[model samples]
Target: MASVHPRVPESGIMSRPRPRHLAPVALLIVSALTLVGCGSDDESSEPPVASATEAEQETPGPDDEPTEPEDDTSLADFLRSAKVDDALVNRLGEVGDANGYGLGEGVETSLEERQQLATVQVGTCRDVAVGHRTWEGIQASDVSSGGTEEQAAAMADFLREEFCPHVAPYKEAPLPKQSLGGPEEDAKGGRGLASPVSWWDTRYRRVSWSEECAAQTGQPIGDPVAYRLSDDAVVCATVPPAEQLKKHLISVDVVFAEPVGEERAQDAALSLLPIDAVAEDETEGTNPDWSYLEGGCLNLNIQSQDLEDVVAGLKENAEPWAHAVHYSDGATADGAVGPYTGEVKQVSLSTGRNEPTDSGDLTC
Candidate 1:
């Protein structure tokens, strides 16, 4: 046999050994190609496992919907979050252990009505904050009552910040001063400023004749006849049909002025009455001068149509005096001696003077 070389495969001569580093890389490429070729076309197939970092970094797909956030900004929610007292919360229309605050149509008040209540509450708080009115005065107001001083302050801040931002201006703007009496004072006296004098009228409501007429009587009576009962009281009567010429007493109010003490006010009111006027009734053990009028003041229920003529005559006689006379309808009759434009010192239905009684005496 001719020299036989080790049988070498014909392919072995053309192929060279891959480097060790490249061998692993070549194996990976081949494995990937094998996976791609063997993979199913269906999208339902399991996806490839992601690395820890890649998994977290994955974005939401088309069908991945986001959830809506819960609403935590409502008034009720705000009250709860603020940790307000249950009693105070009840006043704000929030459901609480206490009764409703009598705002709007009870607890189920409309949005508009609630807003109105908030406005009023905020305004009152502003008054208290500005020192124009006290927290004690809140109870005296017909609109805003029943809230405590602390509650009033808190609710004012809450409403201004969360509820009624439009009323924020009231925080800076000071309101006109009101003659508000404290609860203790109101309890001692009837209303308004507490006074010792019997003739001092404190129960007077600041209402116009028309407003009083509409309030007292169901219907709105036009151009009702008014009479000056005394400096403090004006009796507004409804003018019925011609057949019923007798006017009905609808409302009684005081000709308001700066409050003086009870004794001086009583004396002033007593001095304003017509000299010829007779006592409607008498209370025993009272001063004889005060006995002329009932309740230490003129009768508010006086139903005399002739009182207009009497008032006119008294006004004519008073023209020569130095002071100005304040009438019920807010008209002032100037006297000859002085055009006295000061606040009416006093007014009472029980008192009047046809002639000047005493120039130094203050007019009720």
Candidate 2:
């Protein structure tokens, strides 16, 4: 400039030349000082912009993980989060759904009307998790017909992980076999019928009664014979002896408040005895009164091949008989036959009068 640089315009200014390396250093220093000055001047100023790596480390990305679910989340909320069908969820919240879930009576009354819906939905899930109810059963039910297998499984898993952790082990556990009055304990001695009369005497006074005798013992007989023991009792017997004898072998004594007719006596006998032993024709043309017998006794023929099995069945069914006659009817009879004594033989029943003395005033 001092040596007379060519006529430069006034708008254009000329500056002294500097090293390129120093230029970059000076620029960085100026930026740092500007940031410092800004921070010092205003305590509330914005912070410095973060670098690419710093921003990534400090800020969450779209793929950031979610936190754990809260314990108090409602069943509908959970099911929706699990992607369960909305139709199924709404149906589950309907009234009387608790009973459908196997939550027996009083649920509606015990819980608030608002709470019942959630309770039922949660109960269904818990039952499925604990092996009390099946996922298939739930699917077949009206409430969950629209839900798929995956949705059902998810509900069970939700119950295990959230509501009831104790049910988790049962989720894989084998369901217990249904009981069908399984085989009873073996009869101790040779099987023969014994009366509950002896046991009844200890509890109530023994009533005495006379009986009319009848027999058809030689050949295989076609029909059972009825002997009236009292106004409320009748003894029906299979005429043919189980073995060679002059008396009936299988006898069923029925006692009730009403007078027992021949038809009633035959029906009662068939009910107590095994079906295989009775002829097909024997059941024909008979309108069996299926009403419960008040008090009764059975004399099992000692010669029977399945005496032990028959006795076991009788013992297993004793509770219902006791309930019907003794407890409900307020009778003094034990209502069930006594334990087998192994002493009653063909000769013991020779008189053909097999009345049971268990019922106090209603002996038969």
Candidate 3:
């Protein structure tokens, strides 16, 4: 399932990758929820969606898994409640009642990462909130049912009524059918825009991002920053330090993807920041002891000395990158690794996240 809204195609964003295959988020794959319910109005449209994978695989078994809350009823009842105040204390205490199954890279605190956290039995309120909202709105419709234009019309309609008005404060405000972003690209790079600014992600404003260019440059951003969602797959940010440090460096970008999930993004970027903590911290005990991987940290720290060099190289240069190069062994073209035909949907170098759509129009 693609992550974009059923009506929109995924060719909104694109990223130019460097050689050596170091960038983590090579491909942005959003498994979109099936929004247009099946059958008819008689039956409840909501089918059981995959909350996440079963914990038996990635997580440690009974021997290594934690055993805190043996009783499952109390926990479920507590989470489903409108009032969790009294149970809050007990809830925090009972967090690890089950084993930490399938939490390999761990869960991400932001909405972007909730996609991976859904796999576990235990989760944070934020985790539950984000995942629930995303999957709950799954509207699955047959592509042929509403011709592409018809789908685009439906999408435009949805944005107009349910999604657009809230787009005012965004960098790219007015989302007309003619275009979703700014002006058209000119010979001398006149006016510009990529896609319509999205509000689906902003429904929950917990994410933190800057309004302008927040590169790692110590100087100032000379350009206006623009970002777009690949339907439901990206969250871009023009962050601060990135902007502050933009002078001496080339460029620094980050990407979060499946399997390893969102927490990895936080972990990856954390080491780059000046501070040791963030409002949304990494997963508890998420980093393993990979102390022996040459210069690689269990947390996957990029060389502190080389950060500026890498960023400088990225910003000052331009080269096409292919995400398929980073795939693990055994992944296939038709299977896990595929002949990736998705479109590059979003690019926010500030926060280093990119979302792609599978519309088959990508330059890659």
Candidate 4:
């Protein structure tokens, strides 16, 4: 679905990505055999979704001859080269059960198999013909249905768990220690971005992404940093690292469409900072009503190497960001990612918060 949430972080707090992608999470309160569902009632309009079930009856397979043009011309060569024989499908089951996720015998299959199985299994299901299309730069899953999202998530999770050590494309032997956090948070402690602030620090966090995400992002694929794809929508921070605070780098998630290259993406990322525009308010007493925005991470090590430029980019971008209204907080900002977009939103621009260090370095 086309997201009403801006593809990129709009300038301000109120303008962050909306959390529309997240499935409604209801807290099931179970007491003495009585189950009371407790959560925001706003999601009451959503349909009672069903999970993807194993194919009860397989439909006659598609013709060997091509029916329509390949769904994704980009994937033609890969599909042709990659074997999807009965052996591979069976392997999926073996891997699934071995991993203990209970994918069982038929739940695990390739994108092609999922489409074919859907034809007969779910009457209303539409085949996600082989193709590649990213939503806001994330790889969109080939399967899209009530339980498809859950299935895709589970598959990605188990595949990474079992195969990442040897098969993951992004795993490097001497992988750099990394931490996710904001500019303010130190590598030692304090909450800044998320974690893994260092490239090769021992305290870094281990990250993983799904094969669907790897295929869709079309980046340095087969890596842990690959942007995670979603069947329905996306959440920030949960996928790849957006803009890294270490060496400054941006991803399509932040800049929107094709960034062209590192230079262009860097420039665009810097634009979002709005440092110059907010100079007058940069003083200690300055307190512009600030909020947060978010972007996606490409997981690429490429960078501009100019840390100042990166901070400036954050400052510049936040100035004009379209702010979203916070019904609970009674606050607003330039823009936001979505309701479930997660953290890594906009960094604080308040004078004290964005103040420079003794060496004149940006704090966050």
Instruction: Give the count of colliding residue pairs in each prediction.
Output: 14, 1, 41, 67
Q: Write the per-residue lDDT of candidate 1 for residues 220-263, one digit (tens) a residue.
A: 11223333334544433222211112122112223333434434
For residues 322-363, what per-residue lDDT tens digits would candidate 2 score against the true structure?
Answer: 100111111111121222122111111211112222431222
How many residue pairs in model 3 have overlapping backbones? 41
Worst 10 residues of 3 by lDDT: 290-299
Error of 3 at 124 (Å): 5.3
- Candidate 4 similarity to native, TM-score: 0.22
Q: Largest TM-score belongs to which candidate? A: 1
lDDT of 1: 0.28
lDDT of each: 0.28, 0.28, 0.23, 0.25
Which regions of candidate 3 deviate over 4 angstroms?
A: 1-86, 98-235, 238-339, 348-364
Off by over 4 Å in 4: 1-90, 93-162, 165-276, 279-364
Worst 10 residues of 2 by lDDT: 1-10
CA error at residue 297 for candidate 4, angstroms: 16
Error of 2 at 27 (Å): 89
Candidate 1 runs further than 4 Å off: 1-99, 102-108, 115-119, 122-132, 136-263, 267-364
Q: What is the lDDT of residue 276 in candidate 2?
A: 30
lDDT of 3 by residue, 168-230 (tens): 221222322322333232222211111112322222121223322121111111111223322
Q: What is the lDDT, from 0 to 100, of the residue 287 in candidate 1?
A: 14
For TM-score, candidate 2 versus 3, the one ahead is 3
